[model samples]
Target: MKTFVLTALFVTIAGLSGCDRSSQGFSLPQGNAELGEQVFVKYQCLSCHTMAGYETDTENLPGSMETPVALGGQVSRIRTYPELVTSVINPSHRLAEGYEAESDQSVMPSFNDVMTVTELVNLVYFLEDHYELEPYPRTDYVSPH
Candidate 1:
């Protein structure tokens, strides 16, 4: 009963905030976040997206989006590995809520032809490391007299 209540409360809070979470049966082996960072730079993901601690030189890059999309930070819920993988491989699956009007479709270009499987796994690992779940504030209740 206690677990159920807690979970229900958590879900309510999460729904009121920003979060991304989806998972399929598939799972990948644990990857190296360090190598993922290299892959991120190699692909120049910073041109249109920004992650914590990564430098931005979007202006210098040949093709850069006007407003860069932020990647990792405090989130209301866990960004499951499958969702992140899907996000990287098929960005069109879910468009960022507020930015849909900015572009007809996702501005992110396909890297399927160029990025290696190892790089994709590593990039997901790096992303998984960066997203921190925001602390949930417990709701208070008082019995009616």
Candidate 2:
């Protein structure tokens, strides 16, 4: 009777511990960030979202989107690997700032179906490491009159 009670308690504790974690028991892949950068540009993610200050190498990759977007509240808030993965997989979950509206929708294409599991993990890491919402420069673009 004592052994049964102890086993039950152990099982209950393990189950409760798993419930508190939000990663759904998945681990990130070990892809090279340099390779991930190539994949990112090849996949054309640089077309819409701009990193805080780092400019895209346009000489090699001509015809890329030149306009820099303001990384506002929504972009600034994400600070974890899971958060970045969520943003990529489920873009509609958090709308980018200045783009929150029924009509001004997300231009970020749904790659959930296209990107492989490895690619997804690499992409998440790349984005998380490169662009940050906090400590992000908020330089305003001024149009010359």
Candidate 3:
């Protein structure tokens, strides 16, 4: 009875921990950020998004977004690996703030069919580099005697 209670509690905690990001309990191969950068460019991600140190060739874009989504910059919350993976694979799962009301489900196309798993892994590594997490205040614990 005690074990069952604990198990249920753990399951609930995991579900509530992340905002619609729970990896289906799996991991990918170690990735090379440099190769990931190449993948990012190859996919022409900058066509609809902005990132520091990267440029979009506006003149040659297949099509342009009415508004550009901004990627990696100073962030209050830490973006975890699983969250990033979900963001890339299932973009429509959670729409970015301002984009939620759009008629289109998602501006980002499905790359699951065209992009190799390795490229996905590598691209995650590359994107991780651009995120700058802001440090938070550390809690000073009071030891009870």
**For model 2, how does the per-residue alpha-carbon lDDT over 70-129 read when each residue is reduced to its tens digit?**
322345465676777777787778775655545655555688787887787667656656
Better of 2 and 3 by lDDT: 3
Per-candidate TM-score against the hidden true structure: 0.70, 0.54, 0.68
Write one digit per residue (lDDT tens) for candidate 1, span 34-78: 999999899888877778898876784434345678888988787
- The model with the greater TM-score, 1 or 2, is 1
Model 1, CA-based lDDT? 0.78
The segments of candidate 3 whose C-alpha lies over 4 angstroms from its true place after superposition are: 1-25, 58-64, 101-104, 137-145
Candidate 1 displacement at residue 35 in angstroms: 0.4
With a 3 Å backbone cut-off (N, CA, C), the pairs that clash in candidate 2 are 76-133
User: How close to the true structure is residue 20 of candidate 3, measured as C-alpha lDDT?
Assistant: 34
- How accurate locally, in lDDT, is each candidate? 0.78, 0.60, 0.78
Query: Which number leads on TM-score?
Result: 1
